[model samples]
Target: MNKKEDSPSSLDLIWGVSEIAKMIGRTERQTYHMIQSGNLPMVKQVGERYVASRSKLIAFFIEDAA
Candidate 1:
């Protein structure tokens, strides 16, 4: 299989709750709570899972920091 076909153009384009949690050094459960509280922006839905846009998430933190 071609590597490009197997993975995304950019790994950060879409991140699952576990990936986001790992990036922020938080647990998956905590990340879910943040999503439920509307603190974090949720991305497109793929089936039953919620993924987040990397750029949007970064922007969210940047705006939050301001």
Candidate 2:
């Protein structure tokens, strides 16, 4: 087995705004705007991509819900 495969890259743990939006029940447009404007937590632009970590977003929203 490959070491890189065994330990996933940070990029592998994140999802684009569209996917993240679906997971959080928000519209893709709104999610994209929010993330782009830095209104959402745990989202950032890496090179040409906007991405957020699945676990971090889950924790953030859960804490927010509480």
lDDT tens string, model 1, 1-66?
A: 677656654555665788878766689999889878887855555687778867678788878889
Q: How accurate is candidate 1 locally (lDDT)?
A: 0.74
Candidate 2 structure lDDT? 0.76
Total clashes, candidate 1? Answer: 0
Q: Each candidate: how many clashes?
A: 0, 0
lDDT of 2 by residue, 1-66 (tens): 767766755544666677878877899899888786876867877787777777778888888889
Task: Write down the TM-score of every candidate.
Answer: 0.67, 0.73
lDDT of each: 0.74, 0.76
Please give the RMSD of candidate 1 to the true structure.
3.0
Per-model RMSD to reference:
3.0, 2.3
Q: Assess the local accuracy of residue 52 in candidate 1 as a C-alpha lDDT between 0 and 100.
A: 80
